[model samples]
Target: MKIKLGLLYGGKSAEHEVSLLTARAVSQAINFDKYEVYPIFITKVGEWIKGNPLMGPVDTVESLKISKETIRPNSITSFLPIDGDDASHLDVIFPLLHGPNGEDGTVQGLLEVMNLPYVGNGVLASAAGMDKVVMKQLFNEAGLAQVPYVHFIRNEWKNSQTALLQKMEGNLKWPLFVKPANLGSSVGITKVANREELLTAVEVAFKYDRKIIVEQGIVARELEMSVLGNDEPRCSIAGEVLPTKDFYDYEAKYEDGTTNYAIPAEVSPELLEKMKDAAIRAFKVLDCSGLVRADFFVTDDEEVIINEVNTLPGFTPISMYPKLWMESGLAYSDLIEELIALAMERFEEKQ
Candidate 1:
């Protein structure tokens, strides 16, 4: 019998469009003969719509746009198995969501309560990874070297704006990067070189989340490596993000053709070894499962600094996660299969 797999995508987050694209890409890459694929789409306005099992691979994104009649916004009773509501049971779930709400452990908690197996990080890992401040703390505990950063909640910033500004200015250097602490895909991120810009950037970041993070910017090459498996996770070869734009923001990462990537980046053996050590350390420290994308900054002096770990990184055809794995001799289809297997393995282990 073919295993039942649910492609959970299109969440109530800023990365909704990216989730849609990932759903389509996974549908195309999934081995239809081995798994009965179903679509569990969460609408932009927070509707959970379960689509029928895909007969075969899809070619367009529109086909994966699963929708249904209104059933109240933010209500998951339509498909979610809660309050004894019988959801279409699946062997496992592949959540292709990013950013807040879905990728930040809220959805993972739901899955855990339902006793369902879903691909990627568990609650603690997802929650911590989504919050920049928390992730940095965990990294520090793991003896990981990271750039200097400061974080604050909304009320703290409001009550002590002057003190917070002074704290940031005194602790961090110029050319700071302000971001929403619990968001991804560069949704609410700003690079500021002065106080005026810093004030504006904080307000901008507040538009997305209650917490904010300000990191001291560095002139280093952006490198990323993919980690897979559970207890014995391994790291793939590193990939370099060569963005022509000033910063690797949303527009530069997904919008136009301003960004270029170098697969299997040219790194010395020592550098690669250092990155592998850091990536695996980041993965193990968070107790991550299924997969993770460990992004880093390598200075000219070959210093490897842990930037962050994307619990559920992008799986698009051009996403750095899968691209690095592919360059390491794992095909896209095989990579998806490995992730599914990892999910099942983790689920069974917990039993």
Candidate 2:
């Protein structure tokens, strides 16, 4: 029998539009002969809706607003209980969400409580991977190479600019990146050149999240590797992203579409091997399952520093995650099948 797969996407995240793109790509890639796909879309207002209208080509934001159905929280149409008599009701849930409420363990926690099988990492790993500050701390504790960073609460910056500036200057240097700790897709991120820009950047970042993180910006090549499976995960050939700006900002990533990626990135074989090794280590360290896209930065000196891991990386036809795997010899349909098998395996293990 074909498995009933609930594909969850879109959420109250800065990356909501990107999530829609991912959902559309995933829904199209899955083999219909092996599984039945259910598209569950969440709106920007945090409404979990169901229906065929939610799935879209998603070339623009205006299209999603018109196509999506709004679902109320805890409504029978919104959430499904795992204890129902029909065990075949929903074989698994594949979350193609990005940023805060979607990829940051909030949705994973709900799945765990509901006893539902879902793809990707569990609560702890999802939460750890979402918070830049916390993820960096865990990486540091694991002896992983990463850029130095400092975190600040919103109130600290709001109430006392004098002390906050003093602490940041003392701990970090100029050319720092101020970011909302819980956001992704390069949203609410600013690369400050000096002290004056730092204050404004902090204020802007705080508007998006309660906590903010400032990291010493690294001038290095951006590399990414896609990992698959659990326990002993496998890494794909490394890929390099050539951003169309000073950095991979929001505009460069999605809007301009000028960004180009080189699969099997032009790097020394030794350096490539090291990056793959580091990527797998970081994935296992975080107890991640299913699939994760690990990003890294290779310095001029050949040192590899992990950037961050995306538990639910983008899934658009042009997305790097699927592209990397395709270059590594896995077809899009095969990749989807593997993820489903892994999710079912993880569920069985937990049961």
Candidate 3:
């Protein structure tokens, strides 16, 4: 019998559109003969809608967004995969979601509670990886070299705005990159070269998350590597992100078509080795499963800095994660198949 695979996409987070795109890509690439594909979309307003298993691969994103009229919004009853919810039962789930509610362990927790095997990082890894400050702390524990930075919550920033500003200015260098502690896809990241920009950036970041991180900007090359598997995860060859803009922000990453990627980045053998080691170390430190996109910064002097690890990194055909793997000789469809197997393996181990 064909395995039942549910494609969980469309979330309440800012990366909702990216999720839709990913669902479309996965559907187009999925082996229909091996697994029956189902669509479970979470609308922008947080509606849980389930569509029937596709007779073939999805041709457009609009088909994937069609909701079953019987299913109510925000209803968990349909997702439990129990007796009452017959059609929702599945062998595995591929959560093609990025950022916040979907990628930050909230959805993972739900899957765990329902005893369903879902692809990607578990609760601990997802939660830790979602929060920049927490991920940095884990990197520190793993002996990872990272840039200097500071973090604060909305309340702290409000109560001691002056002190926080002073601390940030004193501790970090100029041209800082401020980011929402618990968001991804560069949703609320801002590059500030001065005090005025810093204040504005903080307010903007707070709009997405309660906490914010301000890292000292560095003059270094942006490199990324893909990590796959569970206990014995491995890293792919490094890829470079070349942004036409001042920095790689939300627009450059997914919109505006201003970002260019260099697959199999030009790195010395020694530097590549260092990056591979660092990426695997970050993966193991967070106890990540399935896959992770480990992004880094290599300075002019070849100094490697751990920027951050994306627990559920972009999985589109053009996304760095899959592109890096493809350069390493893994086809897109095979990569997805491997991730699903790894998910089942992790779930069995948990049981």
Q: List RMSD in Å for every model shown.
A: 2.0, 3.0, 1.4
lDDT of 1 at 37: 95
Off by over 4 Å in 3: 69-74, 84-86
Task: Spell out the clash pairs found in candidate 3.
Answer: none
Model 2 misplaced regions, further than 4 Å: 52-71, 76-88, 158-160
How close is every model to the real structure, measured as TM-score? 0.95, 0.91, 0.97
CA-lDDT, candidates in order: 0.89, 0.82, 0.90
Give lDDT tens digits, candidate 1, residues 125-214: 999999999999999999999989889999999899999899999999999999999888888899999999999999999988899999
Worst 10 residues of 1 by lDDT: 69-78
- Scored by lDDT, model 2 comes in at 0.82
Model 1 segments more than 4 A misplaced: 68-87
Q: What tens-digit string does per-residue lDDT give for candidate 3 at 1-351? A: 999998999988888888999999998889999999888888888877778898887778888887675455446667676666667788899999988888899999988987999999999999999999999999999999999999999899879989988898899999999999988888889999999998888889988889999999999999999999999998899999999889998788877999888998999999999999999999999999999999899999999999999999999998999999999999999999999999999999988
Model 1: how far residue 94 lies from native, Å: 0.7
What TM-score, to 2 decimals, does candidate 1 have? 0.95
Give me candidate 3's TM-score against the actual structure: 0.97
**What TM value does model 2 have?**
0.91
